[model samples]
Target: MTKLERSQIDFSTFMLYRLAEHWGKSVPDTYRILDKANAIDGYLVPCYDMLHTLGSEYLVNDLTDYVREQGICI
Candidate 1:
């Protein structure tokens, strides 16, 4: 998997949106959860470690699929 840059706000937001959709939670709530869990890095970047900590393998897989579909190179 490509490493997503911490500066990619649009990409990060899209991931958050997709995660929220998959988890059936509101976007803000999802952010809150990640924030509380310290899963988000500075600048709101989400990493593989975060996903693993959250036990969100399905979400990670979905994100990979989404990135592939979008042709995003990290």
Candidate 2:
């Protein structure tokens, strides 16, 4: 993969763990919820440039909002 692609993946993984921790869920569970909502591919990856610059709490909140906006329960 290109360097940029790798960077995005890394950032996405970081956010996944952060969100999982914030939600008191396991990493795998967090990943499943995110995948079910299409947040990883449809939102996170596409918005990586802008998102990677945001703070951790803000990014987690943004992701929480995005997932909820998609009508996901968790």
- For TM-score, the strongest prediction is 2
**True lDDT of residue 64, candidate 2:** 96
- Against the true structure, what is every candidate's RMSD? 11.9, 0.6
lDDT of 1 by residue, 13-65 (tens): 66677767766879898666555544445423545445434434565465545
**Count of clashes in candidate 2:** 0
Relative to the unseen true structure, what is the C-alpha lDDT of residue 14 in candidate 2, on a scale of 0 to 100?
98
| Over 4 Å off, model 1 | 1-7, 42-74
Error of 1 at 70 (Å): 29
> What residue pairs clash in candidate 1, if any at all?
none
- Model 2's TM-score against the true structure: 0.97
Error of 2 at 42 (Å): 0.5
Instruction: Tell me the RMSD of model 2 versus the true structure.
Output: 0.6
Give per-residue CA lDDT, model 2, range 1-74, as digits (tens): 99999999999999999999999999999999999889999999999999899999999999999899999998
